[model samples]
Target: MTPSPGRSYPILISVILVGLVALALGTQPIKPIMSNWPAALNIAAPDVLALPTAAPPAAISGAALITGVAQAQGEGETALEVYMAQSDVQEDVGEGQVRFTRRDVAGGALELLVLRLDEHTNIRVINADGATPGSDERGDTTWTDGQRHLRTVQEMTTAPYALRENSELLGAIAFGFHGEPRTANEGTVVIDGQVLRSNPGRATLCITHERRAEIGRFSSEDLARCAQAIGGGPVLLWDTLIANPDVATAEGEFLPFNPLGEDFVQLDWRKKIYNGRYPKTAAGIGLLESGESFLVLATSYDMTGIDLARQLRDMGCYAALGGDDDTSTQTVWRGQLTRARDVRPVPAAIGVYVRTQ
Candidate 1:
């Protein structure tokens, strides 16, 4: 059964040095959990979680990033968050735990949260209600229209799925219910072996019950064994090539936008999101110096799928997929959420969490 988020972790030592400086200069040290995280995710609560950043990456374009620009920086927007497109910026949240990276492009900015996959770190798929996956017809009307169910991402990660220290969210871009009614989530969603929804044939991200990660067009047997899995795609970056990223749904339709969002959000249900520029988010595995790791990215401003794929490829991602474009793109890391326009509550998400065992 899914429970609500009702827990908090004690302060860790990584930020203590910064905290000491805060104490010395009479300034408040930055904490792992942000106070307004829950509110940012549209969750009604006293406490919250996060979405963090790292160093600014190589500029993808020639846009001058001069001013600080951030929609909801922690405690509020630091000047850096405001005009980040001017230069690349990143921060070390936990020395050996979760690493945050931020990069700026001409018309947009990208934030990446990296969590090493060891015995202690892992990933999971969350559904707003314990039972319904966003793609399923049984529920999650919030994505198709208004939030008639009143569920939040917080509820999606409650109780049996509560997080420990150092956790981050990856946008899978479950799907925006606009355009043709036939266009919906392309694949299936399976949590702990219980199939929440199913479309079967499509690109899939599978995390074994034992927590091994794999991405491919899996067979029925492969998907059934998955402990946590989310399937849908117009693959963003696959095998070093820009995979099929032009389609939005199983029907091969064009950008199917969320009506709640602006009409010019620049989204394509099919391949158009990749072809056009708009706020985007992506999730995939990266080949880091240490080993294979999971990475999530969010961008404010505007960017194309090609640029996003190149950026992920630049970051060493062997494979990646666009989560969704425009306001459907949101993330939470260390109690912080990425800044974007048309921020809407998502019914499904793939999150990185700390293992209690």
Candidate 2:
């Protein structure tokens, strides 16, 4: 459409006057709407696997990992350096009742799910067969010589294996995590107020009838406080600090089949087994703005027991103990696998549920 010259001149003059008025008013230019990332929400990147490093020394085999004992302890390798964000994704998934955070750490990520310990939520220890394994932990603390033998029990499974068998847990979990026992059962396990196995000084997860949770060494004084408990050692976090930074000190061997025919050999596989930013999990309790809360944490990639403790402290945890690491590290949040798929079948788990309010 062509404007007449007389009308165009008036329009130009009006535009000029508006421009001068805008300049005097200090009007700012509109920012461009970016079709791509420059819109600047600057959201944290998604989780990723750690970069490849030299192949770490492999444990002899899967069966070897399941049954081999450590003859001599090896020094832990210096961990790969990383920078975890002070805070990352903290979306409250189940209204304000449950929250999950996946904080970025270097190239990988760590996950934390905090469930409010309010009147609406409840927690319990779920064993695979609804019974604690009827096996006693018998073997040497260390085998100085290989020519000895002590028959022991082997009852290990994946997280999903334990999670699926319990019908009570299927539809009720707000969040759940694999309980301590990994290669072989260590520490203490108490189910339904009955002590299935009792050994003091292992990192223990204790839940009282009141829904209060505790993580620390299993001891006599602590026994009565726990209606349910699961033992995973080296206790990594306590009193809100990195408590046991040296959980890598291998405890002993797990050879149930007695392949070498010696009863057992002492081995510390923590440092070597959970190598270089491999995923790890833990159960803990922390004080938040709401009050003390239950915590189930995992690293998507790149963390050890010590690293996990540091992160938990940063996330407001007062105390915690290690869960199984590597593939044994698994979590379920509101019926979703926090990891991609269930690669392992565990024998036991801690399940949290919402009460029928």
Candidate 3:
């Protein structure tokens, strides 16, 4: 509404007085007006600003998981350049976990990639067999080779390129990628003749197994001052255990056909195939001497193993576990229950094999 000139004149005079007062107070709040008001009025520009966007989540995935520090390379590309750009992949590959699987597609197959973050993390991938034939790892150190094969599975799922017969260059590229990428063309790629690719980024490709052993948490030991505890116990018969940073969040916690529960209760797949306790996280055995229990602890690949061992020792722990491998020598439970009649000789041993008669 337009004001009457009589009232508008007073308003203008009041504004002028206020502006002068502000200037006298040395508080020049009209700097924008003084600097650009004339130019703005001449141009007739609207006084508005665009809003900003929210930051994306720290984690991003195209197809597979990127654990620790990782980068992806497409087919026929050299990942050495990408790997050297930032060595985060080294820590990630060396420290973190990833999982790869074949996914069936309409025309052929695709590959699924999953990555995990943190030590006790888990990532689950649905329809994880679309890009290549289902894989079951075999052999001792050959598991490393299996990890390399996962890269081809990833390429088949994500790349539009194909590998040349006996291509060393392609193999090198796959080995260089921390979270292996896969592809099709490497046939029998489809499983159950179905195409998979349900969730791209949502798929979990890594698992972190963190185990703890407390002195007061378990049974007692008879040795002079030695106890034992173990995670991933009752090791599989033919299947050896490796520190896998792949296979969703419950990688080491699960087995084929015995997936983890929604709440991540690792299924006792070993029970179905073996005769002992399935994979375990931590087990503690206390050394009882003079009615005082000395704690013994063990865990899987957790950096806190040494710290825990030290703390237990400080608390008079007889024996403890510490190492970077899943198969460390510190994790064990020694006693009559362990079926070892001569338990004194096997006091602080980890990775002990027991038969549940």
Candidate 4:
């Protein structure tokens, strides 16, 4: 019959070829479990299949200086808690570890630390350029001039110039809020027209009793209360202290020390004095008779009152007052060395006095 039409030599050859392919595949070696995969291809294997120990800590470069005002204590202990900034990693010096080199805000600069979370950072306070990075969305309605309107504003215009003006005198920055107690340092300390420099990272601000008063940062009414508590009184004239002559001068006169003090009383009976004299009046007191009303300078801390009186005596304006707390006040005023109508002549240096009104 035609050699059984269904079975041909070509068909048998095709079947054999298919069977060989199947056999080859079945006999091939099983891919070693991915754990056994070739070294070159196993880049991201889990621990069960890992070939090496844990990776070393990611290398960080010093190029990224994560700067923020240090809020921890300057205790110098390796507590790990004192050196951290406002973020996760803090700079510190441990047993053989080196923290950032501590540089003075200026010469004779001191630093303070705060431990509260969710607080505005020192950068935000001192950097006049800092802005809130988040958004605030609240719909509100107002009627003015017999009209109704809707407003959507995210950021509020804050006063940074004020902060910049008082930066040097400020020690820290504290957020000022309404309806708060006179918690931290709150009152105001009036100084001579000695202009202070406001530097970032080194300023200190504190809030007080007023509905909202932040000193250095912002001050509220509470500060007034603190000034009152200090037993405010008339300005004392002591010939022992003199103004810093290195500062600005006018008509051969240095700005008086604590020129802005309000309660001023000239206790010195002598005639003349140098502006930069300290509190030992050995010679004639330097004359601040510059005619400035608020020619007093404010200091971060207390000074030797008696010694200041002595210095004023050495200058021409010989006579000193023992008005300790009287030098403190609640009002803020400006004083200068110019003999202009608007400007008042600062008192002599050892002539630190309060102008009590």
**lDDT for each candidate structure:** 0.45, 0.45, 0.21, 0.21
The candidate that wins on TM-score is 1
Which 10-residue span in candidate 3 carries the lowest summed lDDT? Answer: 168-177
lDDT (tens digit, per residue) of candidate 2 on 203-294: 45676666666654344344565677776644454443343323232223211121111111122355444344766667656544433445
Model 4 ranges off by over 4 Å: 1-181, 184-290, 293-303, 312-357
Per-residue lDDT tens digits for candidate 4, residues 1-357, read 677656787788999999999999999964311111122123222212111122111221111121111111112222222323322222232321222211122122111111111111111221112211111121011111222211100011122322332222112112211011211111122112111111111112221122111111111222232211111111122212223323332112222332212212231321122222222111111222221111112221122332333222222232222211212111111221111112111111111111121
The reply for model 3, stretches above 4 Å from the true place, is 1-266, 273-282, 295-357
Q: Lowest lDDT 10-mer window, candidate 4?
A: 148-157
Flag regions of model 1 displaced more than 4 Å. 1-96, 134-186, 244-269, 288-291, 297-300
Q: State TM-scores per candidate.
A: 0.56, 0.54, 0.15, 0.17
Better of 1 and 2 by lDDT: 1
Could you tell me the lDDT of residue 351 within candidate 2? 64
TM-score of 3: 0.15
Q: What would the TM-score be for candidate 4 when compared with the true structure?
A: 0.17
In model 2, which regions exceed 4 Å deviation?
Answer: 1-94, 136-184, 243-267, 289-291
| lDDT for position 225 in model 1 | 64
Model 1 agreement with the true structure over 1-357: per-residue lDDT tens digits: 654444222335547777787788775542211111122223222121121122121211111110111111121112222333333445543453455566777776677665555556666665544334333233321233323332234344443444435544422223322222322233456766875544322345666665545555443444666777775444565444444333222122112222111112223444466567766666655533433444444443477776776665555555565555566666555444545334665556666665443
Candidate 2 has an lDDT of: 0.45
Best by lDDT: 1
